[model samples]
Target: MDLIGALPRLAARRPPVLLVTMPGATRERLAVEAELTGRDWPSAPGPAAAAGLVVAGRAGGAQWLGDLWNGMPRPRAYVAVAHAGDAPHALDLLGRLLSSGREGDAPRAVSAGAPRGAPGQGGGDGPDHHPGAPGSGARETPGDEDGRSGRGGQEGRNGRGQARGQGRGQGQGRKQGRALGLGQGRGQEQGQEQEQGERGQEQERGQEQERGQERGQGQERGQGQGHGGHRGGVAGLPMAGRADDRDGLRLDRLHLPLGPALADWPAGLVLDVALQGDVLQSAEAHPWEAAPAGRYPFWGEPWLRAAGGEAVTRGAAERRRCASHLDSVGRFLAVSGWPRPAARARRLRDRLLQGAAAGELAPEVLRLTRGVARSRTLRWLTRGLGELPAGRARELGVTGPALAADGDVHARLRVWLGEIERSVHGMDDPRALTGVDGPRGRLDGPRPPSRLLLAALLPLLPGAEFACARLILASFDPDPDEFVGAGHG
Candidate 1:
């Protein structure tokens, strides 16, 4: 490689990998613990900082994924892992790609120039389609002689024009009096006045026609689309309505969608959020997909398989449970900004999945649980966030640790810890499993346990600050695969 080409490769000496989780692909835990340096986007400063993306799951769609791939700077690479066992191999390939220089291998979307500063490339939508970007608001309006819409800009222009017109009018009248010989020009002045009057009427007629055209277009757009047309606000969002805010100021509420690709967030889950400043005003939970086809819901696999009449050993179930709890803990820690502990939790999870014996893994689990649970700081930060009332939990169909913890994130952590401790002891059981006691909750019904948790979580986020809302969500750490019936965690 030339000096310019080799620079990117040299810069990638242990570059961070961006992990992209897909539905039913539970191999992300392995990738995160695979000794490969990993970084997250949107939260990782910018798109150009990472070496490559490690996608751990099936690649169903292309457009959104392409945009995400394109948004990265040149010399980027991507590798997909089909299963947990594939992570090491994918990481190895990623390392090779990064070391050798990814310039030639960059995705086609990048060479074509993809949208930047967009969330996951803002999907298949056109440029500036993402939230907070100037969208269709740039369209020229008939009423806008100065290329701006709304009353304020036009009024400002009109006011300035009127001032200029007044000055010009006074000057013209004096000039006409001087041209006709001051005192003898009364009739001439009258004639000039009549001409001026006619001209003013013509100008007014023209202005009225333009105004009428603008109104007609605006009306058509309102009938064809909504208030701001298909492309709304300055950012192309439907114009937000004003509501009383915390400081008693009327503020515009923005509906932002999070996830489906966010780091440490559930795969295939999208939360539509109504935000006022940094506070969540309202939120709704929806999934990008239901249970994915042809994969076991990774987190609840052992119990689910057992429910389906397959013989699953109690030891296997216990291992899954232990790993599942560890995964959740890792995500919670990551969201809490405790990356070191989060990495440790993921490492422990990977070891359990690798078939480590309970005797060997017990100490690490103890250290993690003890260190995390005893952290007065973590508890203080997370306590009382997203508290779910017991009655409401049942009403919303939430069970498991969320319900057990009285719906508080702090209490939920404790439940997870207790479950992990119990799971370690049961890891040696040799009997066949028959019930549906999965990590998230019972998997007896057609619905996934995470769905209930998601539903319950949406309602709780509305009034919380952004950071607290994220922490609260991380506490639940609902896995999408559990609902999809594909991939056991």
Candidate 2:
């Protein structure tokens, strides 16, 4: 029936793709997302389900990239799009690779039982082993490390192996008990101490059963110690240390580094946090490594050029400001568990960037901003979260919408809506932009406003739940591009 040949063709029809964005590559990311949306291809939720990976932007020396690539299942394809203009071609290449059943020069798939620390698997003696780390000996499941849906076959095999070992141990115990019974029978025939001999044999059989159980348990433990050894941790990762949580209760605190690659998160930003059961105990923001010197930050380009004595019109700056807010709104909505509005927001952002006139975009923009504003459900979800009062924000050198909102997550959202509405109306303004303020904040500061935004996160995130923490970060929506080629704060 030629079924083997047909398999690739069938799988290629709509292969789920994982989209990765590098820092300073928002334009590339937007282009790739637009292409994928047009094709109606589904996005892979995690490495386990990805059939192809499309990295949008240059492949910098990020260690997580290698780890994620190695964790995906076999028969996969990969392509990197360094420029926005190259997204379509990169995707076409991905499709061809998937349909041709060729993996090209990617590393060989590591066996489920292979030790993670082995050569070329990307594992080492360092504590860099996370769930999806290359050769970390950990299974890459969807969502969390403890999840179990992705690797069912390997788990089943291990389960069956344990069962067989237990069965063999019991069988040996039975044989040993039978031999003791025969000896006891011979002793009974020799003397009148038959009762005592039978009691001794019964005790021996009980002891033998205990030994059999011990052997079975030992075998199970050995099987469980895949590559990590028995250090009392999952998947060879170190055990989480215990700490006193906010409520004065001791809990296990797991150290997790978020971002630099997470979806809807700021590119090139990494937040290292110690969490005690989803409650962040502490957080530290790692300074983003600057990109090459000549590349300008995308959203703040107009203002930056204006500051450099270039003639930039107010209308162009306003258009960029609106688009920037739309982008942030899209990310915030997506992270808030509202994907439909998020997609609409991105569509509007793309239209604005493509030079749509104010008359054409005003109605759609108003519709989206109003829809998000009037959503009581979204308001309820975000209200009273990530509170940064105006005084506190001023104290931290914060400005812009964060200072304007001066309240909580909902307040920041309101500020964005207001700014977006105002900017939309000013898209036709022809006056020269005298001010050096960009979408995020003033561009003439000693440090970028985003740096102050990043600083604010240190105080706001610790008391919030994990999901709330993400929402708070989205509310701030610090653009990593602003930090490119700039000194650390």
Candidate 3:
């Protein structure tokens, strides 16, 4: 039985996939075939863990692609989708790649001579043990009474003990000398043991004294003392000024960057958040390089094309809108930690993308809406969260779900469900597309409404817990591609 001959059969087994999504790459959202083919999208899959790689959307920067390719495990398959609509084609290519196995483009095994483990560390055969480790044969030498084997203290003591025994043996009569030698040997051993005990005691006292001194120094340093008048930076990180926390106690500020590459987050939006405990103290958003030049934002494409006078059909536009709403709903559900409905929403979204007629889609959509809306736990979690007053929303020029929901995440979901229902009915209007209404907002404006949505959301995050803050942001589901196409960084 040749092991190499078995490789092809083993490779045919269903492969787990790691999705590396880039800006404008929403193809992974429509992966309905994943369930059918036994493909899994785990929360986090490393290169070695995933047997296949899917680069969704146009490939991103060269550095990112290179890193991903380098990290992929052997026996790996790769497929790329140039646009969100090309997911099905990419899946076909991926299937062929996987099925080919060792006969075609299977990944090469790692070189036997490849360098292993961290720098200066032994090869990856597991951890290296020190002299103090168990099974290391590190027992103290019999003569090392002072435990300072490196200082030659044990050698000197042994020499003196032998000399005392020998001198006593010479001074006494033959038989008496043998007995004296034995007695002196016993006495010398006792003396050495006593000295070793005293030495150990002294060493412990010295260590305690040193620790006391260090603690005093640490206390001085803790009193807002630092080299440049800043509280000693946390391990070289700059220390911002202190602020009053919710408990009225002043606390140091820590700035952390979340997302731009986070799980379930919109791609390319980085939030530089200042946090105290699990609470968001403040946040500033930095957008990534604008979406690739010239492509319409996927969620708003229909309205954008219509506004551009492309003579788009109303049914097509409505289909896009419903799909867009489902996309948002799926993401919201995922962030809320409810995967069942989120997956259902995504399946419906894919069905819509595959040209499912409204008559066929309406029942499931209604069922999903009813099931999600009936979740009392979800409502309790989202209630009163990120409240956007109507006047303020209008002042900020926000439209779409934000305006319709009057600004709470709970209300926003309600508005999304209502719009999805309306979209189903509007599918057969047969009218020529004229307006710029989209899932996010009107597309006739110079700037996408989502840009304003992110801005309006910043103020709502300060007092919220980090988890709630993430949910609030997910509820909005602002498209980062909008910012990129608008020339934002």
Candidate 4:
């Protein structure tokens, strides 16, 4: 029936894509996301599930990109869209490549090894199987330096020892026969006794080796239980260290970095965190790159241009501000585990960016915002999270909605909703722009507002759980493009 051959073609109709966004590539990312949504093609959450890799914008010398591509299952496709306008063509090419079913059309993997089975197959030890991932089984014990099993090596050593023992016994018997001139029977008896002793010693040594191997296996099992039911380290990586948690109890602290390639994550924003039992002990924010000097940050462009005496219209600035909030709202919703509202927010944002008039977007925007604002469940989930008093924010040189919210995650969300409503109504204003404040913060600050946002994270993340930490970052939603060429660290 050739069902196996036909599977690739069937799956190619709408292959899942793993989209990677590089630093300073928000415009291209948005374009790619919008295109994917239009086609009803699903987005793959990770490389393990992806049938293709779609990178929006340049690779920016990110070495991890190649690793991610190699980790995906074979018969995969890849495309890089350097410009927002190129997203459609790039994705179209990806689809064609996936459907072609020709090995030569597939993107070359970084590793020369044959393609591995899908994740969870092959004893759940495939390249994409992360030991820490939920439901992953125990990790296979690492082999010795020469790639030989410990048991096999131990047996080989034991065999050689037995051979040496026999040779020595034979030599002793012959020497006794020649030197002492003992009877042949006596010499043979002595030789047999010597050989038996040697064999007994070898048996004892083999037993000790087996016991040692058992102890090692037991220790590994204990370590796996202490961690996530998998070995602590993989690929020669070191194991996590122990540290006192918030409750004063010592626990394993894993240093994990949430990345530059995660889905719904900010472009180029990397949060290096030390986590103990799902709670963050500390977090450091590193902006990978910044917009080049004289290049405007995408979300803050209107305000920055207006501040530069470009004579931008107030209506245009308001529209940009509205779109910015929508974008942030979408990311927050997605991270909060609400996909439908997140998709809706993104659609609204795209419509605004496409120059849709206020009259056409106001109704939908109002409905989305109202729904999000009135959800008790949402409020309950976010209330008392990422709290930052107005006084504290001002002390940190923070501005914009973060300062205005003056409370928790819920407060920040409310501020965004309020500003979105206000801006949507003002999108038609004809007056020239007068304020230098951008969607994020004041453009005239000594440093970029996003830098302040990044700095604020160091303090806010330490006491929060890992999930709450992600929400806090999403609420802040610092645009990395603002740091470009700004010598950010």
Q: Give each prediction's root-mean-square deviation over alpha carbons.
A: 14.7, 12.0, 19.7, 15.9
TM-scores vs. true structure, each candidate? 0.71, 0.74, 0.65, 0.74
Give the better candidate number (3 or 4) by lDDT.
4
lDDT per residue, candidate 1, 342-434, as tens digits?
878887887788788899989889988988889999888877888888898888877778888885889999999999988988999999998
Q: How well is each residue in 1-489 modelled by candidate 4, as lDDT tens digits?
A: 988778888888899888877667778788988999899899876666678777665553343454455445668876665567767766776777777776424242111132221222221124333222333231122211211111100001111111111112122222321221223334445445555676658766555555444545644553454345122333322247888988889888866555656666677666656778667888776646534355577887777777767888999999999999999999899878888998999999999989999999999999999999999998998889989999999999999999999999889999999999999999999899989788888878778888898887568888777678778888998887877733222
Models ranked on lDDT: 2, 4, 1, 3
Residue 63 in candidate 4 has what lDDT? 37
The window of 10 residues in a row where model 3 has the poorest summed lDDT is 150-159
Task: Give candidate 1's TM-score.
Answer: 0.71
lDDT of 2 by residue, 173-283 (tens): 224322212333334343443334666586665555555555545444533442132122222222467779888998887665565555677776766677787678887
| Model 3, TM vs. native | 0.65
**Model 3 lDDT per residue over 15-69, tens place:** 6665555565454434523332335434322333456656554443322233333
| Residue 383 alpha-carbon offset, candidate 3, angstroms | 1.3
Clashing pairs in 4: 290-483, 290-484, 291-484
